[model samples]
Target: MDAELLQRFNPEEFYRHFLADGLRPDGRQLRQSRAAELRKGALGSACGSASLRLGRSSVLAGVRAELATEEALGRVEVSVELPALAGALFREKHRALGLMSFLSNTLTELLNSPAVFDPAQLAVQKEVCWMLNVHILCLNYDGNAFDLCLLAAIAALEDTRLPALMAESGEVPRLAVAAPGSELVAEARQLALLARPLPTTFAQMPGGQWVLDPCAAEESLGASVSLCLVEGRWLVFHQGGGADAGRFLEELMPLARGEMSKLTRLLEN
Candidate 1:
């Protein structure tokens, strides 16, 4: 084929052509989504932890709790780390700094918001309160970091257990956490988490065909949608793809709902 003809058959065009017939480069059907595997309590040293793998991307989250040392609006803290071992993309001096900063800051802000996770569950009025610190590490970069990180963090929090505070009879009356695995600790409530905002990513091909949960190669190739769903409600709709937003709402909205349902079930199990 001539250069002009080859250019005419670009990857996006070919992908659209195949997608119209329910085919993909990775052999998935047009509406098929990648499976996610979550292993709760994976980190022994941490208070609570979970390791989640979405396709080839891996995210690990650990939840630690301690007495609040500084004044803050909420009881939860979130930090995202993309180490060099995760991918060479993370090792770039300037680029990685910017990307990590954006991810961490955005998630931290959203998590502290009242709608995502309930902070009241972590607080015991004015008497006693514990601050939860969530640390997430990207073990591998295969795209879908936003959704996978949220998945791991939520699962870890759900798996977390806090030791009940015990009153110590001393001159100062210091409070101490009950020993782990003790009867008092066993009675403490598990972290209370609300039904969450599930993230769904879609890649738009040249002919307006949409692919959900795009892989790494698909992500860098073009623009896409990063949407979040909670009980079928659209919490956030981020446009990162070249596709028409109107057409996407008209054609792919139902597909995204199906994806949200699937992800919700995955998190439940």
Candidate 2:
């Protein structure tokens, strides 16, 4: 194709035609997501951390175990931040901030729920519980920020360990501080979550093709489908743009299940 002809070519229309036949311009099937990568224990200062990537996009998550001021156990605080560098690479600071806010609120709600993780596990007994601070930073943004953030956070939780805690009855049975990673500490490591709460997102292209794990380009022109699998059931089916989306779950379920399988293998390895 010459430059003049290529200049007039229509990529969107091409995508539509290709999608009609159950294919994408990138040669992936309709239900396939981009290859995903997970790196656990990336932050040395954090109690536990993990980095995750889907194609060019990446996120890093960390867990910090802090002494609780209140008597409540299993209380979690989550924060999502996009540094100036990340904003410059992606979009304007204000726009980036808005995007982060949306993702952050959704993640906060999900993680706060018992279906995602049991907060009760953070407690030692009835006396007190550890306050878990979960932070997620955007290293890169391709398309699925929610999915990547959740995965990274979960991986970070898996990697997290606490210093041996001691309680002595002086003023009010205050927590004792033992050195981190000390053999004298009785409970340093917490077990990972047994339920693998893998979430995946899909998007519908202009041609009404439901594409799983859309990249930056596809995401620009598609409606989104985000969901998490909970004990063999789907929770939080957030689909946007069209009313017909209700029936789309028939296709989305298999794709979400496949993503769950992929994430499970990543964690296991």
Candidate 3:
């Protein structure tokens, strides 16, 4: 039988054959991760934006700032869109909605956490402030969407610039976006992030082997775990299948830390 026919009919068998030889169909070792590419300020209209590609998975994130009342001050709202064209799984409406909700809520919580971003920075005064609306769109889905989304969000937020606040006595303050060549352009300030969080994702193959940065085919075959590191603390998310969670952490912590370090360096540069 040809390779394509075997893969189409018996993906498990095909994957097992490759694993037996200590390789993946993509020619990567079990412990290897895909290369990531990132670009900031990809959107001209938004306050900030970033485009990130992790292996074949691509995501774009944009941030827009709006004036808000005291009650909504310093709030960040996140929304994720996963269209059918991105992947076969998303072709089902329910599955796409479920995953979209999960990713949106998870990212909103992470971005709003004080350990990552300080809400106080958004405060313009006592009753006026800025609210950030962040939107993430997945252009391709090859697996590891969570990691790609989070990193894209961080990059967009870092690229964001808040306009100058204009206040008048006994009146609500407004934001001022300086025109080109205006001196007030210098007054606009970049958003300050308190911590840099990065995620390393691993897929647990059926045979009890964990593969780092699994592609779409490998992901469909097993459970997955994502470990995010922020300021010396870890946030873990696991889905489907069961294993010795503690043991998994023990074995993967070093690799995860190393991956986070590399990502941190990327952001810094």
Q: Which candidate number has the best TM-score?
A: 3
lDDT of 1 by residue, 1-269 (tens): 45446435576655655667788767887667777898998999887899999888999999998765344334678888888888877787687677677667766766666677777676643645778899999999988677888778878888888767655568985556766544442246688666676777777666666677887766665777767665566745454555666866776677777776677677777
Q: In model 1, how many backbone clashes occur?
A: 3
Better model by lDDT: candidate 1 vs candidate 2: 2
Model 3 misplacement above 4 A? 167-186
lDDT of 3 by residue, 25-132 (tens): 999999998898999999999999999998899999999998777564587889999999899889999999999999999999998998999998887766767889
Q: Record all residue pairs in model 3 with backbone atoms less than 3 Å apart, i.e. clashing.
A: none
Model 2 lDDT per residue over 1-269, tens place:
55334324755775777778888777889888788888999999999999988888898899888876556667667788877555353557777777678777777776777766777777766656788888999876777777888888888888888767665558675666665554442376664675767888887788776778887667667578778886787766554577375555676777677777777888767
Error of 3 at 49 (Å): 0.7
Worst ten in a row by lDDT for model 1: 179-188
Give model 3 RMSD, 1 decimal.
2.5
